[model samples]
Target chain A: MEPVTTIHGRAYPFGQKNVDTDVIIPSHWLKTITREGLGRGAFETLRADPDNLFDSVEFAGSPILVAGDNFGCGSSREHAAWALLDLGIRAVIAPSFSDIFSGNAFKNGILTVVLPQAAIDRLIEVAQSQPIHIDLDSQTVTTPFQDRFAFDIDPFRKTCLLNGLDEVGLTLAQGDAIGAFEDTVRVERPFLAVGVGS
Target chain B: MATTHPRTLYQKIWDAHVVERRDDGTCLIYIDRHLVHEVTSPQAFEALRLAGRTVRRPDLTLAVPDHNLPTTARRDAAGQRIAIADRESAQQLAALERNAPAFGIRYIGDADAEQGIVHVVGPEQGFSLPGATIVCGDSHTACHGGLGALAFGIGTSEVEHVLATQTLLLKQSKSMEVRVEGDLGPGVTAKDLVLHITGVLGAAGGTGYVIEYTGAAIRALSIEGRLTVSNMAIEHGARAGLIAPDDTTVAYVKGRPYAPKGADWDKAVAWWRSLATDPGAVYDKVVVIDAAAIVPSVTWGTSPEDVVPITGVVPAPDSFADASKRDAAAKSLAYMGLTAGQAMASVEIQNVFIGSCTNSRIEDLRAAAAVLKGRHKAPHVKWAIVVPGSGLVKAMAEAEGLDRVFVDAGFEWREPGCSACLGMNPDKVPAGERCASTSNRNFVGRQGPGARTHLVSPAMAAAAAVAGHLTDVRDMI
Candidate 1:
């Protein structure tokens, strides 16, 4: 994953609430063996309208998306995250997000910023013509109109996004701890280890 | 000077699985079971290949193809493999078929009798165990929590992480108790109860919380009913939902293929019995529900929360107090092509689907079968199909002659897979058609492009098929 520090760009002011993963990429596009080129399928249903914000000249290739509450509410498909990244969405500002979607976004280096609905409403209005700026270090989202909103994120996830940590490598480095846990479990709960690694 | 800590069922499982805890409250938790399906795993395998990481515990992981496979048939009359018509879907399924064996993990193939939806296959095979931490790439993996497992969905990246490390880095979720007391009224099923709960909780109500369902009504439900309720935890925005194991859960797990035997079973049951929440255990949130208030329910809009009792009428957007909810309701009304004030039973449907991870067990099949036993689908109901969750479920249903009941009712008794639920295959409801479906999620275009789905229970779907519209199963019963 690439280190994410700051994102500044036009935002697609799509404020549809309860936007599920089925709408993010849809099941039809899930057939790909790889993650590339999913941008074409991202919000395919909404983009069917040629005048939709995603395809509008003013917001084309925007790095930020301003959305309504409960954004990414269904399905744990990482393709939703990949599709956002493919569409150049580096950060999403919403009143709230589904837990799985937020986690997926964080893992893929996409910032999910939650603010009050009042702030989200203001951002959507300002996002129409202005470029929004987000700074991970400051944990803030700001518009050129002096509108600024602070956000909260998990401290561990914040460090990971800023440093582009490799989670697998980090976990693998603790093989000794993992092995020790497994040894203890082998004795304490032998049934769990049954038929495993045979 | 010290008192013993009272723990929730979730806390018990979480503490048992922690391999390491970080200063920031993030813990590396061991995953005891990993369920894999075709749609979300190809990239995970590729990542493993790129990282040169072999699976940490191949035996703990199980793979099966379901999402994109056609439910029509996989073999000819002469027993030859029939090629999947959709090239992309075939390739995706083939990728899993290759990846699972290559990675030394068990793969239940398309023709295997054990094959079915990953969630259904897990508990049926006893791969999902009590107090185990299970993760799958699909959100409905919460289904395993019905069996007392701490299971939740993961994205593809986490899929790779679990495959390579057999552990997930995570922070513990706030615990919630959804207590449903009193007996469910006649014709009220677990599906109806869950649908009613979704309406009460809204789509994001359980976000960031692991809910433990309890109380009298929940205890009265059978294991299959419990599975139906837990399967929709994701729909309520909870990653995992659990019902602590009791004799019902133990009986369901016993004699299954992977269940421990003899002394191990006795010991496992002892631990499982101890997994229930302790007296005075505190929760971050509590929701008390009256089971008697539930009825045969159906979704009226594109969101699962847009639900109402079968006797109710479609709600106007103005009925919602929240501005965002009002706007969403209006949009959902538009997309669903439903009119406010219309009777829910009067809404005509051209299709009926009686299967999904949400409700496709033998019990579910019998429920639908009982409704359709002496009836046939209405002529105007162009298509009605019952796809079992797994091949085992199908075989079990056939043993009880439920397939004959469905077939005699003019409904197709199809092979098991996630058919018509997400519409990645040929069983999709045609565009512009309304379907009474017993699947999770009524999202736009979920069954197919321009397809409007009204979520209901198996019996309700069967009743709808016979009436050619959405109707209360209570009437039929």
Candidate 2:
């Protein structure tokens, strides 16, 4: 994972609401052995439309996606995040997100910017002709027309995002304490210890 | 004044799992049981291999193949149960079998006696114990919370992390209490209760909170019924749903394959008994629902919350207070092929599917078989099938001759798997068809492209299969 502080580019500008993980990446695409090359399957259903925004050159290679409320509302498939990352989307601006999808996006180095619905609407409109800007350090998403929206993120998630700390890195940071806890559990609850007295 | 301390069941489990607290109010929580399925674990295992890492505690993890199993074939000519049908599914299951040994993780495939839906197998095998923290990459992991465990879904990234380190970094979720009082009326069930609750709370109501289901009605339910209620907690938008362990829970877990024996069992039961929420415990939110008020419920729209009692009518979008919700309702009505103000009972169906972690238990099978007994499916019904939650459930159902009853009733008595739930397998409602399903989630194209699903209880689904339309199970009973 890489640190994600800022994301700036033309957003997809589609304000579809309740867009589930199935629509993001259908279950058929989930059969793959690897997460690579998922961009082809991202929005496969929507991209089937001749007038789909995802395939439109105007939003092609967009680093940001401005969406509606309850985005990523179904399934715990990390492929939804993987597909978005593969499609070059670095940030998603929505009114709200499913907790599972939000966590997946963060872990995959994709920023999920939760703004008010009104702010999201404005961003979608501005994204039609101008690029959208997101600054995680400032916790604000801005547009060229002097439109600025501040958002709040969990301070812990923010720190992790800034530091590029995956769970492995995070856990390794508490190595000594984790080691001590294991020793105590081994002594106190030997039954719970893995492969102990087996 | 003396300080009064109140702790919820969630808090007790959270505190017990906390290994170390971070400055951000998050803690490293030790995970007791980690469940995995075919759809999610392949990538995580690949990541572990690439990183040259091994599972920290393989004994705590279990894997099964369900999402892609063939529900049609129980066994091949060689007397071995079919693990998968298609090439893609085969690759995923093969990966689990190959990876499990290398990591020392237990792999339960179709050939295994304990094989079935991951959620169902976990509890059936006594792996989902009370006061424990369980996790899986699948969102329905919350289903284990019925046994008084703290379980929730995780992403593949977290799955990989758990494989490497048997702990998850997390902040404790706020708690909510849902109290259901009074005895349930005849023909009403945990499915009806949960569907009614989702209707009142909406799909996103449980988000960011871990809910404790308490009160007389919840306590009165059988272990299987409680599991059904906790299984759909995710549908309420809650992170997890829990029911504190009682005598019923202890009875169900005792003597199982993984359950402790002798003195350890006594000690375990003592600790589990103490896990109940303390009196005067204050929750962030509390909802009281009268059990008598709930009727046989059915979902009428794309979302689980878009539900109504069997006797109720489809709601008009204008009845909603919020404009966005109103629009969403209208869209759902269109996609579901329903009219505003139309009676839900009048809707016809082509397929009836009764299987999922939500309602595929042996008890659910018995309920449907009871409804179908001495009756045949309607001539107009195209297809109806019953998939058990696990191999054990399937074997038990067969032993009771429930399979014969279903077969005689024109319902396919299929092998165990998550068939037609998410349409990852071959059993699916065809496009443009209307189905009365016992599975969770009625999302558009959930069963198949353009498939419209009406969520119902197993009995209701059986009744619908017999009537060739939406019919109340109460009438059949």
* Cα TM-score per model: 0.83, 0.83
DockQ for every model, please: 0.37, 0.29
User: How well does chain A score by TM in each candidate?
Assistant: 0.87, 0.90
TM-score of candidate 2 restricted to chain B? Answer: 0.98
The complex in candidate 1 yields a DockQ of 0.37
Q: Evaluate model 1: give its lDDT.
A: 0.91
User: What tens-digit string does per-residue lDDT give for candidate 2 at A121-197?
Assistant: 88878989999889999999888999989999988789988887766767867777766777866554433454211
lDDT of 1 by residue, A1-198 (tens): 678899998988888899999999997687799776899999999999989989888898999998888999888778899899999999998889999999888877899999999998898899888889999999998889998888999888888888876687678888899989989777777667663346
iRMS of each prediction in angstroms?
2.0, 2.9
In model 1, the runs with Cα more than 4 Å from the true position are A1-30, A36-165, A195-197, B1-3
TM-score of 1: 0.83
Model 2: lDDT of residue B2? 26
CA lDDT of B181 in candidate 1? 96
